[model samples]
Target chain A: MKELSVKELFEKKKKDFALSVITQPRTLNNTISEAQLNRPGMALAGYLDRFSYKRVQMLGETEISYLQTFSDDALYERLKEMFEYGIPCIFITKGLSVPHQMEYLANEMNIALISSRLTTEKLALNLSQYLRNYFAPKRSLHGTLVDVFGVGILITGSSGIGKSECALDLVERGHRLIADDLVKITLQNNTLMGTPARDAGWFMEIRGVGIVDIERMFGIQAVRLRKQIEVQVELMPWRDNMDYERIGLKNNWSSIHGVNIPVIYLPVSPGKNVSVIIEVISMNHILKTFGYDAAEAYTRRLKEEIKRQSRRNR
Target chain B: MQQKEITVTNKLGLHARPSALLVKTANNFRSELHIIMDDVEVNGKSIMGVMTLAAARGSRLVLQADGVDEDYLLEEIAKLFESNFSED
Candidate 1:
């Protein structure tokens, strides 16, 4: 149900895709409902069955060449046949000359006709990527995101549980901060990508320190535009009767937008070095990825030792 | 000082999670708590110490407490063992 207007797409990709409005309808209000683009070769060939009219039609070299085969009246008829449907817009790639009949139909039918200087394949790839991102599911998380040792760790906790302070400490230790206070998470292809909220500049609000611009203070190396959320670290105040994870044998996971992200429950108390632990966690995650599991290896060693000792006693 | 002999009834015994639960429960009271299993005795309020005992199922552990809340501490810890740490 997500829709994007042609004007917005043209305005956004005008420079990057080399897109130019060839023929603007009375209003550029036509909306693109489908993220996938379509090649109108089959429909232009007089076979409209299964034609996806709800997509942005692309007139590549082949489709344009096929249309060029017809005479003026025949080409007009062919273009009018496809334009009768509710096509959002049309893009002629490789900066192909927009056929006069096609432009006339586009303007008459209120479809935005655009031209891209890039090759057909390149334009399609870039445009599809943009459309996919535009339609991705998004949510905001109340926490800080930082890249510790190339691992994206989302530090979440209660409001005053030092999430920002820990992030600041990590930033001071040369790690990169992605976002603080509010992280905008987008789910794309089952992966959660974290970015700073649109209005949330590179500033963090520490409890006693007020707002500090991290970009200006720490330089460009200390901030990231976006990062894939690799792990989630939840910091909770240490409690007497609360059971914390003492061993890393069992992995904990938290689901965000149906994607399960590994979660670590870290207990915070007086004098506990959370930033150092998070750094270790990031390195440990890397180690695990490389097939070296310290806890599991130690447990296997302990089991073998226990067996050897029992055999000796017997 | 108060002491009681309790058996570890949980199927997984004193693993990481149960040890955490035992330590958390032991910390609730204002008492110096210790768990003695065979020749190894460990502080009941310390997760690492409690895990070191490695007390398996049906192992008899002696709970010793010394302080103002020793009796109440023993009672609460006994409840955790009776419930199998809420695990099957």
Candidate 2:
């Protein structure tokens, strides 16, 4: 199971959320196994049934005000009961002061008590967004991801098959390079988002030229941070007898992280401008998205012409 | 087809230079070669594909070759890995 320690969350979002450690700092190592945060209103009110102890608990203004009405001894008893469930940690939103009794029991129980200055709604919204992304499924692929006219094309092929060379050519023609060599893909909300490997930066390795920095050579406009992988273009060595895709009547799809992306196999050979072909593919893809398929339209016209010829013969 | 499981013993693993050497050796034969690591298989004759494996020291890889010269292809690839791609 993927778990994030409370220390990691605090360290990562300390500046963004205006967070601070309230209780014993030693308890910050508590692991948060769930991405959801819970408001322990019912538990604080002495109802423990169906309590989501696995999630990080949040105490907003409502819960804190409720505890404010109770005596210190009564508040300690109430908090002690809730902490017995082994909850991950608690966040006090709105920069609220941590009650003496609550902090005492939290330290006694070794559960982290954190405070954030953001409003309750804003804190919950931002924290949930971060948590969801932290738990997303990720994979790395050996290919070049580029943004071609707003369409993300992942260029993949064997080693020395000119994938990088083709991507560089596309960059020269005004397309943006997202990643080269290793593309880090994350599945977020059913979309396969492609980004560069953490260490790859904006570099491309050409067979003869070694390594070249794309951003430095082509400027900032020639590269992007991440893009949605809408299509895949696989370059293969051209063979004499290979029957390639002559008509685009059928689409080939590749599934990654349960998302299906359209794939195009293009054969590479001497003197073929693969980059230009990729641009055309991107434009055709955009046209298809707008309900215009050139191959299907051409086939329809051919069928009509054949019908006309048959009628004249009859 | 010929297959062999080899371990990457090179100190730096299969970085750019080692991957290049491995691909160069694999291309000497006419057989189709594939290197499988952790269920992800890639073309062995492609430098980028081999580098993508990122097989560090002590990583295990399965090398498979198919064609009339499959035996020779596997032998050559196995020798490269066994020698740590000629890196100390």
Which regions of candidate 1 deviate over 4 angstroms? Answer: A24-27, A312-314, B3-30, B36-40, B53-63, B68-88
TM-scores of the models, in the order given: 0.85, 0.74
lDDT of 2 by residue, A214-300 (tens): 999999999999999999999999875454565567789999998999999899999999999999999999999999999777555
The candidates' DockQ values read: 0.22, 0.01
The C-alpha stretches of model 2 lying farther than 4 A from their native spots are: A69-74, A240-243, B1-88
Docking class of predicted structure 2: incorrect
How many Å off is the CA of A46 in candidate 1?
3.3
Candidate 1's DockQ: 0.22
Total clashing pairs for each candidate: 0, 1
Model 1, A33-74: lDDT tens per residue?
888889988898889988999988898899888877899999
Candidate 2 overall lDDT versus native: 0.87
